[model samples]
Target: MGGIVPMRDAGRTGTLPATSDELSRLLTVVRRGRVLTVTGRFREPRSRLVREIARRLSSNFCDGAAVVAIGRPFGVRELTAALGCVPGMPFLPYGTADAVSWLAERDMLLVLDGAEHLAPEALAWLRRLLTAAPGLRILASGRSPLAFEGERVHRL
Candidate 1:
């Protein structure tokens, strides 16, 4: 709702981004319309990178940002709530569409931590989210890439 995500934990130091070159590249891509997926076997690298990126860019960007850690098995509804976009009505409880509608046209960065364990169905729904939210930028951390169209998968 504000300049920075209210959920950002400034204290936590997870796995950091690879280097300045990669970090700079990632930042540049997210600023544009590109979806950057920071791939890794563990969640720490992706989580740490998101935190560092947020801390650095929160001072500059007027857009919004939210990071959610999906450490284990979770479904569509849990995924939406995990991202802090709880469905307001009974018609769309835990629906990815609800989350996209909640996002509307706002420019924001969403970090999905521990995405490796997401079910195939959940991953498909996530692709829908990407398509629905044009201004939405995702930085996903997973053992394997989501493999959605236009997804820029960077293995760590």
Candidate 2:
């Protein structure tokens, strides 16, 4: 699938093209055997959206791949559980390097949510994860790019 595009509000006239097709194509490529990072502002009540994408990823990639969300106060445990993966502790305490290494080894999705505050750290983690885990893909939700090399960013 392509990157997740935010639905346009009714009657909105001007905005960036949603590039849903491109995002899907990229997703397909990544699903085959690559890493992807999705960065943008995610809307609240994200369960349904998360579940749908996770379901597709699970179906296509098997259970090895997981969507790991990093942020505060978002009920990530429940969300990951709903997606049928054991929810690990939030990527705090452990430094960015350690967190990335741990998650990469697991071959999980590694979703980084509400990461504006942790952008620098998250970028470092993403770079390491991309290098360390060939099977891992990241779907980050934030207000800006991680600015890593080869990062295919799709804005929301």
TM per candidate comes to 0.76, 0.53
Q: For candidate 2, lDDT tens digit of each residue in 1-156?
A: 112222221123333233567546655745654434445555432322333344446545332334444444333233333233333334332344454455555555545444444534445545666788666665544566656675655555
Give the Cα error of residue 68 in candidate 1, in Å: 0.5
Top lDDT hit: 1
Q: Cα lDDT for residue 85, model 2?
A: 34
What value does the lDDT take at residue 49 in candidate 1? 74
Error of 1 at 18 (Å): 1.7
- How many residue pairs clash (N, CA or C atoms closer than 3 angstroms) in each of the candidate models, in the order given? 0, 7
Deviating ranges (above 4 Å) for candidate 1: 1-17, 58-63, 85-96
Q: How well does model 2 score by local distance difference test? A: 0.46
